[model samples]
Target: MNELNGYDIEDLEVGMTASFSKTITEADIILFAGASGDNNAIHINEDFARTTPFGGRIAHGFLTASTISAAIANRLPGPGTIYIAQEMRFVGPVRPGDTVTARVTVKQLTRERSRAVLLTICSVGDKVVVEGEATVRTTSRARREATV
Candidate 1:
């Protein structure tokens, strides 16, 4: 859960990276389905999933997307990261037991406003499960130093 902690705006920098890994579980899929109200057969009913093109159950897209939060909190903007925007593409299915890793790379910095543009990626093994971009604003490192 340490990976789920975030930091303030003043403590971020461009080129920072944060990565987190977690193993998918059936319970996670079920819980996500209930919490997100996305009870698509592929994520809930195994029998119904058997008829789908994938022929098996898969995790909800947002469940996979949620993994990015951990990376951002623990790595990118550790304590006070604020989410301004996110764009995600679901590229692959996430099955139970697959260990997925989510990573965020700070791609651009807008120093005047204390904002960062980041590229976020989630993968299982060699296959990418999701990719997207996110915007975060954090306390300026200079501001924190000045206060101290």
Candidate 2:
């Protein structure tokens, strides 16, 4: 399915789902640390990370969180999805070589507006790395049909 795009006030609905998955790699952690300037030992220094509570290198929280964007963009609400807000919590660490997956489900839609409430989660193996809720907007069918 195509990503959800610019929605209208009349298009929102509840119980929608979207998702995407990726394997975390050492390179990904390195690049994220360098780009985001979050050079925390746990994320970039293996030896230093070993001494930390997690006992190994872990990916940045935001890096794992960012996977939600890809999930919403590639699946459920495809091309034109508009992100309004996201509330996320990192429940566990994402180490290199772990495969992470994110899934978003629509929980509610405001009838007066084209906005939907989405519940989402990102997981690695059997552990949940991040979970959250997001508000998004998409164009209504009437708007698209008219344009077409």
Candidate 3:
């Protein structure tokens, strides 16, 4: 497994970006359904989903959104970053086998508060699957240890 290299709060700058990608799989959806208790037919029942507007079963929107969260937590300000708020819009459906890439870019930062605002987006190839903004409180190794 590969590990992400994260920056400290002080190192962040507007426009800095980080990303992570994964291929959506049947098992990924099934596990997300179970863990999130979002067993909607549109996500898990293929025969039923085929009758819907999307034409087939789609991955959970949150499951796709979580990819953005992963990128922020693991790649950007990284390990000590605490998510404070998020606003997301699901613009497209993610189906099994689709390769999704989650990307986050620094939009704003408050050095005094150790806070950052990031533009969050998830895409499958060239099509956007999800878009959002996320707010997080970042802590450095010293700050984290102090808090504990």
The list of candidate 2 runs beyond 4 A from truth reads 1-13, 144-148
What TM-score would each prediction reach against the true structure?
0.87, 0.85, 0.91
Ten residues in a row with the worst lDDT in model 1? 1-10
- Enumerate clash totals for all models, in the order shown: 13, 18, 0
Model 1 shows how many backbone clashes? 13
What shift in Å separates residue 27 of candidate 1 from its native position after superposition? Answer: 1.0
Local accuracy of candidate 3 as per-residue lDDT tens digits, 13-125: 89999999989999999999999999999999989999999999999999999888889888887876789999999999999999999999999998878889999999999
Error of 1 at 91 (Å): 0.5
What lDDT, from 0 to 1, does candidate 3 have? Answer: 0.89
RMSD of each predicted structure: 3.2, 2.7, 3.0
Ranking by TM-score: 3, 1, 2
Off by over 4 Å in 3: 1-5, 141-148
**Alpha-carbon RMSD, candidate 1:** 3.2
lDDT of 1 at 85: 94
lDDT of 1 by residue, 18-61 (tens): 78999989999998888878888888888999899889899888
Highest-lDDT candidate: 3
- Measured with C-alpha atoms, the lDDT of residue 113 in candidate 2 is 54
